[model samples]
Target: MTRSSNAPLSVVLAGGGSAGHVSPLLAIAHAIKATVPEAAIVAVGTKDGLETRLVPAAGFELAFIDRIPFPRRPSLDLLKLPMRMSRAIATAKSILRDANADVLVGVGGYVCTPMYLAAKSLGVPIVIHEANTKAGLANKVGARYTTFVGTAFAATQIRHAHLVGMPMRKAVATLDRAAERAAARERLGLDADRPTLIVTGGSLGALRINKAVAASLEALAAAGIQTLHITGKGKAVETASGELLTAPLYQQREYVDGMEDVYAAADLLLCRSGAGTVSEVAAVGLPAVFVPLPIGNGEQARNAAELVAAGAALLVDDASLDAAWIAENVIPLCKDDLRLATMGESAKHLGIRDAAESMAAMVLAASGK
Candidate 1:
């Protein structure tokens, strides 16, 4: 019944689909390795998620699980839920038994439900991490079975939640923008001395945000600011004449591989207020103008709530984000170094630099290590 104290900890982590889930999962795994060098770590994900690529790339063994999407309303999928859950639970039991799993960690995804169920049956301790202000269904179900639940946001509504902040990559957690700004700017072909602004809507980009940035390009350039706009795949900004918009003092890319570099080089950021973006920006102490995506139950707004309240960031509605708004708000803010520094300091004060280590310690404790 007790985890073997002499044995290396065997941990099974479940949660994957988007970068939001996978990125923190990887960060936690790395932190666990840092703490217990000989710990055996395995990730549970679906065959089609970003985890399929990211998990192995991070040098962890990834176990595939059936994707069981929860039905929001009455549907055929809901009718077959019993049989599907039974099969997935059986699969999860097999995975845990084979890995000799001492503890199961769920990070709020579809893959986590079955893992939580299986772990509960096997008497394996469960640790849950909810990354959003509002808990997801999977985490809600997982939370009922264990008390070691951690949250990225203090406002997150989870059972027995402890504030552990967001587990972010070490690159971002350890970044010193002041020390790396010049080199990062040089690498991106930006002027080292000039104020730089970056606009990103994450991997797939945000069309409305891209368009708004495009419309305000002239104003930003006129303010002696350089821009790096990552316009997601196939969502390129075009000119009035129907060609790709390639203006001077502005750079555009479909995506950038290493975002930490962009974070380091930028003087200001204009981005959507996803949990990952909010956490990373705060961790790097990057002053930002967050345009909370005007969708999905206002969780994005909630994610930026603490930072905005602390004067570390501004939250603009998606509809209010236009050329004029950018000109009036972002342009002026980007040029005010004293204000930016103060905001950055406020953000750093709120950012949790050791969340991964904290979560890792939580995992080790639950494993009886």
Candidate 2:
């Protein structure tokens, strides 16, 4: 790797087809900046993904690469994979050269493959951070040339992987439970005395989680439980709000700027089991019912199982997520104060709050910062 005397310790962070990938990269970027104040970080992503908006908003520069979707079924996209990959590699290499990045970190996404290959060609020491229990294809390929690999799950298949857990945003890391609860409730105009359930399906929102929770709004209200739902953007929040408006104690929101308060105010969580979500829930010591996304590599299922086995959370299949089932088996947990506390305590046992620090240290080691 070439380094200039005047340049700061530079890093190229790759990955971002979805929020699942982008959020962790941002978290890591923040951590690196916090730990090594002079470090210069640049994100490598496509123009299409959330990173285009999120990276800049996070106060980092993002360099664009050609779009390269992970091949699913056989189609024209698969046929064009070779050309797309070639262009992506070229784009990544140019960005690396332009930025004078000292090290490359790949956060598992299809866009990462080319970035990793380009970095390897430049003889830059590479690190891969896989946020799922199962390694994504990009991370799996990136791992072969990488000196260090980190994962949210200890059980990830990549060799030489460090079980550092998922890196959470600094905002999440700094949450104060009691203060968060009061502030979150007051901000949302929710009653502080009532039991509150917070339901979310990641940043983009989960349609299945939204539908099931929306259908159960009446039941939740009847059971004397208040609700805070974060539907993904583009979802019809008005439609969901209209359904909840018919009930006595329900709130529907498209998004919240301060998620820490949401976690703080929540008596329980109903959501999907993305790695970042799992880490945040556990970090905040919140009890949850996890419904893993049915698609992808079953990583969400694996993440949920780890918590479920620890008695930190409950796992419900998406197929069985009707209102009746949630009401019958899940709703009662909201009423059990002792059980909720116990679950929260257990969840805290699964949290690695220092994950960001560990990841930052790893990056520093890889980059010789």
Of the candidates shown, which would achieve the greatest TM-score relative to the real structure?
A: 1
For every candidate in turn, the CA RMSD to the true structure comes to: 2.3, 2.4
What are the per-residue Cα lDDT tens digits for candidate 2 across 1-369? Answer: 333456568888998978888988998898888887878788988889999999999998888888787678999999998998888888888888887888898898877889889988998889888998888888988999976898988778887888998888887877767667887789878898998888887777888887887789888888999888888676644463364233568777778887788888899989998888888999889999999889876878998787799888999888888798789867899999999999999988888787778888898898876
Predictions in order: lDDT: 0.91, 0.84
Worst 10 residues of 1 by lDDT: 1-10
Candidate 2: segments with Cα more than 4 A from true spot? 1-5, 70-75, 237-245
Whole-structure CA lDDT of model 2: 0.84
For candidate 1, give the lDDT.
0.91
Model 1, 1-369: lDDT tens digits are: 223455499999999999999999999999999999888889999999999999999999999889998888999999999899999999999999888898999998999999999999999999999999989999999999988998998889889999998999998899999899999888888998888999999876898899899998889889999999989888889888989998779999898888889999998999999999999899899999998888889999999999999999998999989999998899999999999999999999988888899999999889887
Tell me the spans in candidate 1 whose CA falls farther than 4 Å from its real position.
1-7, 240-242
Best by lDDT: 1
